[model samples]
Target chain A: MEWLYVLMPIAGVKIFWPGLIILGVGVGIIGGFFGMGGAWMVTPGLNILGFPMAFAIGTDIAHMAGKSLISTMRHGKFGNVDYKLGMIMLIGTVVGFEIGAQMIMWLERLGSVEKVVRYLYVVLLALIAWMVFHDINVKKKKEAKMVAAGGDAKDAVGVEWHKTFHAIKIPPMMHFNEAGIYCSMWLPVFVSFLTGWLAGILGIGGGLIRMPSLIYIVGCPTHVAVGTDLFEVAISGVYGAGTYTYKGRTELVAAVIMLVGASMGAQVGAVATKYIKGYGIRYAFGLAVIGCIVSIVLKLVAKAQNIPILDDASTAVVLATVSSLSLYILLRFIAGCKKELAEIAAKG
Target chain B: MKTRFIKLFSWCLFACLALPEFAHAAAAKVSNIVIVADTRKFSGWEAWWTNLYNESHLYFALLTMALIPTVGVIFGTFADFLMGFIGIDLKSRGDVGH
Candidate 1:
């Protein structure tokens, strides 16, 4: 039992070292697979693991930066990343992020911003969940119609909102060859700005939000969204890790331990993407969002009722969801690898 | 229609950018709260790490930046190698967009 726990030098807290490894591996897989940093779950998961809230955030950001670097590199190799689009969005992301952070500082003077942020999380998660399901439903209908008309539905997309947005025809129309999108340049900039603002207020990497927007709004393919979002996450994570560390909020030893685990997990997750299609990724993402919502709600209830038990339960729920999802992705990765290798051998 | 949309979008963007200044944070910044690690029981590597944190946060931050990427690249390459040996080519994705 004594060997199970390790002391964090900077935070001065004894943590179950296994918990750190689990979180590292879990976030690495989830982030790599979903193309987003797993902060929504990791922050609460870290607090439950005995880190102070600030350290949890800083440490999570640090590990996510390193983990995202691997995912981005892998995705880039797959031609899933649109570097042109990513570069365009970088402008809005930086500016929007500053505004969001500044607003947070201002909001703090009025009252506790934590409660507001929690409520916002619930609303955002609900909206995202709805959007995901609605898109799936629409896609199914479109495919049915296409098949009924005696046509192939292989490339049918349920969410065509990007087409409507593309009609805006704002000047400086650009093309992203990787994403196969031709739209006004302002679209990506504006979309990234909006997502960046949400991320700033929520204290996250904005991967989840940005991924969907890239698909539904920016009109990118599913794989492109995941890869491009990972690129953005890597960029934001770098800035966040640097800022948090400078502020003396990060626990480096924990971050390193987590980064090592996450790095390996990222490889598995990224490779698994080769076997899973766009909608498959979306379904998994939606489930992760729902998991985050449940954990946040539990935490809120615990705070309201002053129930320590519920708070602990919230932590359990987050870790459970992370563990289960990571395991599933890992198994899928192994299966996909075996099948691919078998086919290659047959070819030989 | 395009003109109307452009005007509206520009206006909204302007407002969002300017809104941050409106809050006029009575305090120009958030409270500068600092932390100290309890290193009384620390020894060896732990003591060195905590001492660096306490003595100079800049160096601590710098080391973290260097360490995370170095470790990540090392681990990433090793994982790629293992997977490659297992017959999944690391350079090209096998079933991209599947």
Candidate 2:
């Protein structure tokens, strides 16, 4: 009986296991598919479940790191990982995270840290959603052109920015064989550092920011960008988790349990990428960004209006939207499995 | 086929051994500076890594068996699914498969 008391600390912390389980599953799916762990999903869910905000963030990062590792490994096998690029991005990420932390401390002095951060979060979410929607339309237009030309859509030329960027011949150039690019190493480092800074300041992984930046700014192929993004996430997340824990902000028990679900989800998500074409991934990733944006917007509106009920409603909407998106990813996985079986049978 | 399998297996082994060590060395290099800078308190890097490892180890240890096979099987399955979903079936490819 005493041993049972010792083992079961959940009794002390008023948490709903069911909520955590659901949250983990949703985050895992998104994380696996997009190379972006669902920290946005997990953190808010934990907060709602009665954990302090700091604990929620700490636990989320812990789960995210594990999940990111599993996905990165899987993506690596599929030849999607660009290690050189990821490493270069690491230099930037570390610097950015530190700078972002300093900025937060500075804002804390101004006594408007919370308000500023919240407002920024809302604005960033909206901006990202807009970007994703814009990209989706661009993709559609590209597809239409290919159809009009009677050419295979797969043969469509990619964005020309990569070539343009490569021609700059900046010193200290580096080559990423997997990404099939040679460019200034400083580019990735600078981009990652900026992303890292944002991640540190906002208290979330910069994946939501980094993924798009990698694609549009750094000009990596989408698949490679996704894989590389996970690599960066793993690195930054580990650092974040450690930093928070040392500061006594981490909830060890919650983090461990969440990791259990995240690791499993990441495996499924990572492998599913193999079956999903680049365009499909792009579309889904875009939608995930939109979902996140909507969730953040609802939260902002609730806060601005000072309506407690709206806050509750926003939380529910966030949970529901995230869960549905996650379910969609799982359904995609199952469909993929069936298709593989059919192909094997046909071969026989 | 055997050679290819061997190559992949070796690569996996290398990655497993190498990455953590790389991460550790990087952390170790900064550990002293990080520790001293924050008035002998824990640095951000230390805090982030420790919690991450703690959380990850639990899941990794628990699911090691299921984890390994899932990667290859699920990936292959997904690839087939994608092709079909995109209407790129072998019948459409005419003589390509044969």
Candidate 3:
């Protein structure tokens, strides 16, 4: 067991090396699949596995920057990334992120950063889960109507907020070709700024908020939202890694080890998106949100009650959720690939 | 209409964000702490890694920023090759119906 542990040079902690790989691959697959940074789980996952809190964040950000780049490139190949939209949103995202970071020190002095952040996470996750499920329910009803009308439900979407947004008739309405949307440029910029600010205050990568917001608020298709959000996350991740490392928090060796697994994991996650389309992805994301909420609540309870057991329970729950979700996605990807291959072979 | 909406929304957000006593935040110091790794038992690359952490955080940070993306590209290309080898089409766009 002692031999299985590896020392992180900068963090100076002996970590279970395989745990690093698991976190890397699990987060890579999950992040790639959801088109988010997967930091919600990874940050705490690292802490449980023996990283100091600051090092966990810095190291995860470092690894995430690389992992997301790989996922973004893979998504780019699939034409899922809306580069134009991503680029337009970058400025607002950066500015918003900085404001959020600066405000954190302010927040800390006001007291209870931990309690406040946990409560905020609970609220945000609850809203996201509700949104995702509501959208799915709406789409299902729409699909039923489409089926009765003898129309295809393959492209039906539950939410039509984008239509109203598109009607705003604001000046400089730019088109995002990859996402097949033409809307006021202000929409994405505003959305990114808001999400970035929230991410900063919450001490998270903004993907959790950004992904859903991209779909419901910015009017992107699920795949495009995932890809474009990954692009944003990757770029911001670079900035995050630099800031944290400069502050002397990042452990590069741990990050490198994670990247080794994350590379393959990103590829698998991105490729899986080709098989699982819109509603399918949304449904899974909703479930993941629920899992996250459960873990956070458990930890919150642990903190308020001063119970170590509940904290352990929280870590177990998140790790299990990540592992199980990855396995499910992997199996689905394999099945989809086989069916596609068989159909192609039969055509010959 | 857009301008009105933006103004209303922005103001509301600003008000909410200001709820946590704005003036009280001036004293917290999250960036003031730094840690140095003990390099006593290590040699060669490990020594260099720790010494860099102790001596120059800027260069260490920059090197990490550079190393990650470079590694990502290398791994991404390799993964592409493996996916192609398994008869997975690497060149065609995915037919994800939005």
Q: Give the candidate number with the greatest DockQ.
A: 3
lDDT of 2 by residue, A130-238 (tens): 6666766776678789999897765443345456666777799887887777788877877787777777678666888888778766777777888899887776566
TM-score of model 2 (first chain only): 0.89
Evaluated at residue B58, the lDDT of candidate 1 is 83
lDDT of 2 at A344: 69
Model 2: per-residue Cα lDDT at residue A39:
73
Fnat for the candidates in order: 0.52, 0.00, 0.63
Task: State the DockQ, from 0 to 1, for candidate 2.
Answer: 0.05
lDDT, candidate 2, equals 0.64
Model 2 misplaced regions, further than 4 Å: A1-11, A111-113, A157-160, B1-98
User: For residues A247-282, what per-residue lDDT tens digits would candidate 1 score against the true structure?
Assistant: 788898899888888988887888888877788888
Q: Tens digits of per-residue lDDT for model 3 on B1-98?
A: 99989977975675345423221221132356768799986889999989988999989989998999888778867877887888887666566665
Q: Which ten residues in a row have the lowest lDDT in candidate 1 chain B?
A: B21-30
Give interface RMSD for all predictions.
4.6, 11.3, 5.2
> Could you tell me the lDDT of residue A210 within candidate 1?
90
At residue B43, give the lDDT of candidate 2. 42
lDDT of 1 at A185: 97
